[model samples]
Target: MTSDRITLLIVDDHPVVRDGLRGMFAAADGFEVLGEAADGVEAVRLTGELDPDVVLMDLRMPGGGGVAAIMELTRAGARAKVLVLTTYDTDSDTLPAIEAGATGYLLKDAPRDELFTAVRAAAEGRTVLSPAVASRLVSRVRAPGGAPGKEPLSAREREVLALVAKGTPNREIARELFISEATVKTHLTHLYAKLGVKDRAAAVATAYDRGILG
Candidate 1:
């Protein structure tokens, strides 16, 4: 990994997609493209060898598939953050990729600036998701089929969680609910403690898993 630049590995079965992403990064200043992989198997090998700061991964591939590759890489202790890049936007597609340990998900149509921003954020351990995808993921988690292994939160907590899942700031949520920001923070603290999550993204994921909000 280069010390100065944000190194990236582009992984996709399509040569066109990989090349396009590489060029896009190359034209930008903060990102340096380290390599490319045409399949999940190659992605795993590259993760071990190159150890890029971020991996721009595609979910559908011929060998090892995107999710499978992420599972393998993470299981083997690869340090790179996986950011799933795909065309699909459904709850099923987003949830599985996240559950399998993807740090972020961006649609192929994401604005270039947003994509680069997400890459930078993911490289630094912050989660990023396309707003629509984030909302869908949150809604699904709060929907039915969420509470099996996890306990549900109170209705007010669910409302707070839904706003959080939509990326609302604490102050903003407070305003929306006609409550104090401290109250919002208090609720988030309790929500995190109960869900065993430390941040907004994890809380959102857990909310969906537990059917606390939709």
Candidate 2:
């Protein structure tokens, strides 16, 4: 929780994965590895004790699962943001973690730069989703499952949201659509309001849940 460095708690059941992440963050600038957890139960305990700025969490573990840990952390009002770093990007995996209050979702194959960006965003209380995870959301939206009636999003907002789902930054999205950055932010805000979400990750998950991206 220092102002200068973003502290992290890496949570995974695999020793190799935890070791790699610890070394990676250690080699990176502006980040500090506070601790590591082998399972959700340990993750929760260390999270409460270390109070890391962000938790790089894995979904499946023997001792406890990530979704349950995230729910517990959210319920307890922990200050750490959970950024799910897993191998699975399926609907069942991504949707539940996002719904459980994860600040971001990223697959294990994510590039180092993308992972760093997502971690920084999560630390800043912003939501981030890897392109693959976002693509999965799009796929889910295209699937045949919709509840009765949900509020509609404007076409422009939908476009913005789609870009957000792909992990596009506001500037890049604006450039792609020939819009200003402020305009991109405005569209994001409107869409967030319509979707009842606070950030990009939640917005994408809600879009999938409501079948809005279709």
Candidate 3:
């Protein structure tokens, strides 16, 4: 509810994306688009110069990747909050950017309102994540040993997890497996314990991340 306008620097390798974002933010109230950069190196330089409140950063670039820029920004104690705006939602992409000090992670497919909300939250130094990214992170923390380990999932559990990854509901999974709903729920609980997750989405993310599912 602060009356001050939030400043932003849009960093992306694609010119079309930059133009679209710049236009979107320009049309929206309470935000000012400071500048645009096509690579991480330029992004870093601009961030230093503009000192924007939030930086909409893309992951992959030619000169330097977003993760590297994020790390550099953190090391340099830059004031802008980096909000990763990328198409990748996998652990390989999300984990590194976050660990490198990105303030938030959002997918390119997010709704315009969601993007605005994420930027606002990031400007205030709050953590924001796309739903898929959040589930992946939660799955990582809940996974046994905090990552893929030697404790392998059981064959039945693997089957259930595979179906879950395919967006199958418990009832559907049970019907397909010729098992009762209660049995499916039991299998899910056991798998959750073994995988160190609390929900279906997290289980799927952890499975994919751990190579339990392709």
Candidate 4:
């Protein structure tokens, strides 16, 4: 049977942020605040114990930043989807979290209703991005490259890479572009080989560094 409430584990460095999130979710319907963690280490530990449906993660923290925790959770095959709630939306911050398997990204200043919708979408394994972040990604992908000597990404490859850079998961990318997941993986493989990178993060970094993803 399907569950009615979405269970959440809120992870932020600030006690106030944690408290605020807890209080907000506690007052809402169709949601449950499972617990809170101050850093990535505790987030990972509690996630294992509590098994929340979604983790509202912060990007920057003193102990093992959010990216590291996201990577660890992906490696450990944790069941919870990570929805990043951070102050930073720069390419450096957004790309890593997405590559590390974050289900969605949202800014800390997002409206309460948007936050609620994002969490629910993430719990259903959908890709969510803040409007600013999405616009930034679109601009980056469409911007012309300064270095003309670099090998060019194919049109479709560029489309896939752009969505990937936007933190869109493979499933969503496939769905949006009307292709199969295997085709998306194939495009990623070719792009990775063309960019000479092993993973999504490296591919994005290389693209930016080479002015391919300006």
Candidate 5:
């Protein structure tokens, strides 16, 4: 394991989930839980105060929710990276979170090792996704005429889209492609317009319908 410990902040409403993540990360080497929050507002406050390197943020909190907190933090100029941790993987949540500047995403049910890897990858600015979600994103890019005369996305776009469908964030995408975050946004914007969609899930569906992501 690497000698450097990645500082992590857990932000989930459920006490059990927070406890579980805290236990899991605590037992693992190279990870330190900087703090925990039970709601979005608290999450925002903690982010400003603690400045953890990575935040495991949940999407649907009672007061503000993950997207709200993320937007607030970003607007406030907090540089901490946000990694979505939620039970729901719908595009509604994924797209908004991505647009709001989350750096990565992971399912609640992911295996322990994969979760650890994802957290580490997020801290290092690499996108992580469950395999099933990746396939869906790939499909959206492959759909024909999805972009209406726009050239099909390059192999890298397809790769990036696959990860996007799985809810991976730009930081992770940049690391995965060995490129800059600005480049990833450029591709995503171009892909969004081509696919005639506004967000990650729509892009994935369009690609699948066109038979590109497959």
Candidate 6:
């Protein structure tokens, strides 16, 4: 937001990574490194305070993780676009972050130019993804049950999802349904796969969006 330069907030647990990103953005002409955070909690706090145009967030860190922070930020309607920057390109890492409301996903090994372009795209609220991540996502979409709200949920899965939509905790849901907590988790997982969502909130929202929860 400083005139034409894109403002950035670097979030990573490693000091070296943060330093490198700070230096990289600082040396670039069209970017300004607003601040750095060591974990997701700090990242959220600083995002509230600094109001950066884009956030370069890392996954899998102590204190807090990136997906949870993305969900929290999205829930709070943060202005900054979160562009996940991490070494993780696996489905478990990628889908959750995207579902949690990340604007883009990039591997840590991305080239300097690619990284800059991603940040710029994210700052403009465009979706960005590294080549590998994009390919994986495409493959996932081609897989069964990959489309959100398309696959029909089983009776038990529907029951679990309905309970989840009410914001009921897992234990309570299990008790109400006369099922074990593990069974509830299994049902949730199955429903999540069928719904093409990663967690409870997304499942409920997607179900409602698709008229499955109405």
lDDT, each prediction: 0.81, 0.85, 0.84, 0.83, 0.78, 0.83
**Which is better, 3 or 4, measured by lDDT?**
3
Kindly list the per-residue Cα lDDT of model 6 for residues 43-73, writing each as its tens digit: 9999999999999999999999999999999
Instruction: Return the candidate ranking by lDDT, descending.
Output: 2, 3, 4, 6, 1, 5
Which is the winner by lDDT between candidate 5 and candidate 6? Answer: 6
Tens digit per residue, CA lDDT, model 3, 116-206? 9888878877667665786677644664544533467788878888877655567788999899989989999888877777776567666
Best by TM-score: 2
Which residue segments of model 3 deviate by more than 4 Å? Answer: 1-3, 143-214
Off by over 4 Å in 4: 138-214
**What's the residue-level lDDT of 16 in candidate 6?**
98
Go through the candidates in order and give the C-alpha RMSD of each one to the true structure: 6.0, 5.0, 9.6, 6.4, 6.1, 14.1
TM-score for predicted model 1 compared with the true structure? 0.71
Poorest 10 consecutive residues of model 4 by lDDT?
A: 140-149
What's model 6's overall lDDT?
A: 0.83
Candidate topping lDDT: 2
lDDT value for model 3: 0.84
Per residue, candidate 2 scores C-alpha lDDT tens digits across 23-60 of 99999999999999999999999999999999999999
TM-score of each: 0.71, 0.74, 0.67, 0.66, 0.67, 0.66
CA deviation > 4 Å runs, candidate 2:
138-185, 189-199, 202-214
TM-score of 5: 0.67
- Models sorted by TM-score, best on top: 2, 1, 5, 3, 4, 6
Q: How close is candidate 2 to the true structure, as a TM-score?
A: 0.74
Give residue 111's error in model 4 in angstroms. 0.6
Quote the lDDT for 69 in model 3: 95
What is candidate 1's local distance difference test score? 0.81
Candidate 4, 113: how far from true, in Å? 0.6
